[model samples]
Target: MPEWWTYRLEDFLLFSPRVYWRMFELHNAAVWPLQIPALALGAIILVWIVRPRQWPDLGSDRLVSIILAAAWVWVAWSFLWNRYATINWAATYVAPAFVLQALLLLWIGSLRGRLHFAADRTVRGVVGLALFLYSLVLHPLVAPLVAPLAGRPIQAAEVFGIAPDPTAIATLGLLSIGAGGAIAWLLLAIPLAWCVVSWATLHAMGASESWIPLTAAGLAVLSRLWPRIGSGALR
Candidate 1:
């Protein structure tokens, strides 16, 4: 891990635009034209692995399920951490979380069991382990590359809407209104909602800095224990 105390904001800022710009472009509006095919490919791979013996005849709309699954993962990840104010090691960890959630939700939404445990375990384990190692060893060097894109920092209480000031309220209100009410609502709601819940759950247990990992591990254990139960149970 990089020495957080030694790293300056400018160092991070210098690194983010190049890496995150590509990620943004791939995920942004201009890529909508390619989404269908990409989604279709994902669906095909999912189907091939999960329930290869019992393929569904969804025909042209097979991609719809995959697309929906991907969207759900994005929303879930954003919901998990966006409300938190700090952009430290934990924030750096969200990328892996997003990918993990995306893949699992993709499998869950398939319904047809289009992706089986063997393939799922291989992919998840490999990717998860790689991410863990990267986050551990390369974090200091790589972190600066994406630091530039970190949004304006805000107070923890302000982020959670505990003690909002007039300026903060107006700024967030404008952002919400400008992005369309629904987008704004997510920006405001998920953090205030899930973060608060996670925090409360952690606090009640008298845990602190390790809360997120503990919560994540607990969820992972639950997920594995009831693999047949589906996303609704764990999600």
Candidate 2:
């Protein structure tokens, strides 16, 4: 076998660039208008985290967690397994991880009531909130700006449930909002790993926002350690 250093970017790629971009295009087409609801869900979660008087029940946290879980399931099946795996076979493995994450979120945030939304007003919370917004609004704006660089259209932009960028970013935000513990560790494993994986994938693809995942991952680590100033209003 060839040595790792000697390998070209293409060697790591299972699909041609055309196939990859087409996958994104088809994914966007398949999930039209769904992104609107995804954006709304994210916004609601962020607002809930930021202000508690509007939603006195901790159940809002649980509800948002379930929404996030559903998004994970949708992408796990619709995008990764259905579209992405056909090109990048490794995505088949990744899909199952997403499913497990969905289940984890459902159990902790819904069934167990273990996922309390605190820690969001800390430095970590600020970073996490920024990432969530980046995934929703900022990243999509780049869709038009990077069109020339990527040779694609706005229609091809990767939305939250339809692609990894927003999903990973949104997850980082939601995960940070919770009280970190064993469940936090379990919840973070897949997303943090995906950030690294996606950083490499986006770098290899020469896509815009290539560095976003890695940056978010780093912030998340720091956010966990120094969250001494969390918002007091979380229930």
Candidate 3:
């Protein structure tokens, strides 16, 4: 394993108990599972109602501008909340990272949209797979940092101007779904989104990291081959 991997694994294991407790809250038994269906239905209803009145301007700068504006909104909200709550630096960091993920997706999706590459099967599939992997890994990696700060008092920090609270960090972690499956869903979603876009963009630019997509594809194929060969010996 890479030196970084060994280090991170050690850190993660050290915090396993806290992580498990946080995981419980993330997957708590409540009205949480219904939230998935509710939110999905609401989103579908929203899109149906707001169906594009004009053909989407795939080449418009508006895509970029809107993305920037949305990002600023999150930042501004965090700034004010942090100011009043005296948020800890660590808590503030968590929100910005989550916002960055959304921004990245919009940026990539918009690029593909502008180039009219969104319809291409190969492009979409590659992006989808990369995102799946990224989302999964990113969560567990960052969890340790924020998890340790959860028990801190909700008092403002002079540096960050916001108080650090478990609620905020946990939510930002996508582990606040109040249940376990929700934690799993978020863990799956965020990294995958990041990877798909990053891989697609790098591949398009013909960067050396293009090997990443190939590696992912190879592993996927190998995974499929594994079960079949193992079954044959048993049969």
Top candidate on lDDT is: 2
lDDT of 2 by residue, 101-198 (tens): 89988988888878766435556666667777777777766667777876778877777766876798778876877746667778888889999988
lDDT of 2 at 65: 80
> Which candidate number has the best TM-score?
2
RMSD of each: 17.9, 3.5, 15.3
Candidate 2's error at 140, in angstroms?
Answer: 1.9
Candidate 2 local lDDT, residue 168: 80
Model 3 per-residue lDDT tens digits across residues 1-235: 5676555322422223333233324332222453344234323322322232225554332242233224333433544223312422333544555465445435433443321211112322233333332322332233343444543111211111111121122112221111122232333244334334334533543344435434443343333244346641222
Off by over 4 Å in 2: 1-9, 53-58, 118-120, 227-235
Clashes of 2: 0
* Residue-wise C-alpha lDDT for candidate 1, range 94-131, written one tens digit per residue: 43544453454344334543322112343232332332
For residue 203, give model 2's deviation from the true position in Å: 1.6
Q: On a 0 to 1 TM-score scale, where does candidate 1 land against the true structure?
A: 0.24
Q: Cα lDDT of model 1 overall?
A: 0.32
- Ordered by lDDT, highest first, the candidates read 2, 1, 3
